[model samples]
Target: MKYLIPLLFAASPVLADAPVVENITYSDGRFDVTLSHGDTGWDDYADGWRVELADGTVLGTRVLAHPHVNEQPFTRSSQIMVPDGVTQVFIRASDNVGGWADDTVPFSPN
Candidate 1:
């Protein structure tokens, strides 16, 4: 049991926190996204968000200044002109330690 405790503690850092998308709104070639994250601090926090195409082309990125420690979930907006033929995009959140979150928001350009 002693060994198990240390192992779990070591693995805790690997279990990085990720940002979750609460809501999304797209209009006039702009995107307003609401995200929820367990931001601890600057060392490991949701640092920024991005808009990407289906093919993985990054359209735009919104850089977050500080960690949203108090704000469990926050909303941010970005104005990006998607490609003409692009019908859909992905909204992804990035963290300092874990990088981008696995939760990719599929956005419809309607």
Candidate 2:
């Protein structure tokens, strides 16, 4: 059946795995995120990253516009307005190939 062929292909692994968060830093209403491939090469993949509040609210999302062709590390910085009295933020990275990763950070808005 036509559906069988598509289903079989869909179940097959094609592209590389998604990147992992190497480190996260937050300060003064801003945050920096670092990502790296884990034993796999993700040089040809395109992905988007996002930051969220503690209550599952999205703060911002950044789409990677270039292919990471080298083994060198990938870093992205974002400026966000943390909600007043909020003490934590969540971050996620998603690849166009349907892989994702998330992490959380604790901070104070002083």
Candidate 3:
């Protein structure tokens, strides 16, 4: 028998909302981030994401080149060098239409 798994994808046409950060993981000096957005077309989509410190300092950024119409809640990775004394960081995702999300996902790389 063949089994199938379900995927969570929410595609919206409203351009007033930002992409949501579905999940994130940290390893060594890199982060694998998953984001979900209502990407109708090229005019609006999840354009970028960034890693930052508690003090609002950005460490790294991953920019989405195009719309993920079929692949909602997509995952991408990027590397950021944390300072010697830093223990944790936060992630913020943005869309071309709505900019950054209201809440941020916190992560600790220890």
Candidate 4:
């Protein structure tokens, strides 16, 4: 799946909205990241989001299905076991056509 997301998005339009990290909530060992993107439809939508270490270890990912056209920006959470002493992680979003958004959301564990 890691190699497939980018290829899927690359086939779509280039003008699609980039996904943005709007909010993050950390509890215990889990996190909830809110993503904002312009979801056009099945052909163009925010496909997924993930939390990873700066070194590129993916902690968790939220897979989105269909398009949240009416919702505009939406929130979703992924639960993962974070290692002890790891204070921060990066959040990334992807659209069907645009692959990964250019912005990486940096979040600190709370």
Candidate 5:
């Protein structure tokens, strides 16, 4: 049953710690935000991710109606309209099965 043991371990789900906003870039009338997480596999739960602006304003949130099977680093790029006079942005994530987590990154508009 040694093989069974390994199989079971592999089948177990890996819970991602949380997601964070690593950086924000503003150029050419576009806003590009990057996200990083302890587990890149969290893309499977991308629907639970969200982006919010300072002062509790939500910019955009994940809308993953279906599970994402991306096999890359734990990062995502989004194109957004640079909010007027926005100084900072917040990134939030949730697992539908639990509460939410968020991180804030400061940036300057072009």
Candidate 6:
């Protein structure tokens, strides 16, 4: 009975807090994505974001250089070479600790 509580406590750090994509905007082949996270410091922050197709083909990525500690929600843009005939794509956000979030934003390049 005592073994379970200690194990859960030890494994608690593995439960990652993923960053959230607040909004996504596309214009003239550029994607501006906004993300919000509980960025305490360099140890935990929203690291990067990407533009990709529905099939998981990454079109472009922006690696956020530093921690936005004071800035709660920030916006960044990237230019992706969205191929022809691809009318829609997905915007995904990531954290420095968790890698990537399963949440995807469906966007139309219209």
TM-score of each: 0.83, 0.68, 0.81, 0.81, 0.50, 0.88
lDDT of 1 by residue, 1-110 (tens): 87999888888867676888788898887788888888888777788899988778899998888888898789888898887777789999888888888769898886
lDDT of candidate 3 over 1-110, digit per residue (tens): 13232222234344468788888888888889999988888988899899989989989999999999899879999887788998889999998888877778898878
Clash pairs detected, candidate 4: 9-96
Model 4 alpha-carbon drift over 4 Å, by segment: 1-13
In order, the Cα lDDT scores of the candidates are 0.84, 0.67, 0.85, 0.81, 0.54, 0.87
Quality of model 4 by C-alpha lDDT: 0.81
Candidate 1 at 44: error in angstroms? 2.2
Summarize candidate 5's per-residue lDDT along 1-110 as a digit string, tens digits: 76999999899876665545566565664555455443334443444555576677777665434333452223444556657776566656654333376445556654
Selected candidate, larger lDDT, 3 vs 5: 3
TM-score of model 1 (CA atoms): 0.83
Instruction: Give the clashing pairs for model 2.
Output: none
- Residue 84 of model 6 has an lDDT of 88
Residue by residue across 1-110, what tens digits does model 2's lDDT show? 87999999899977666667677777776777776654333544536677787777888877776656574467888787777777667777776565565444443444
Ranking by lDDT: 6, 3, 1, 4, 2, 5
TM-score of 4: 0.81
In model 2, the runs with Cα more than 4 Å from the true position are 1-15, 38-46, 99-110
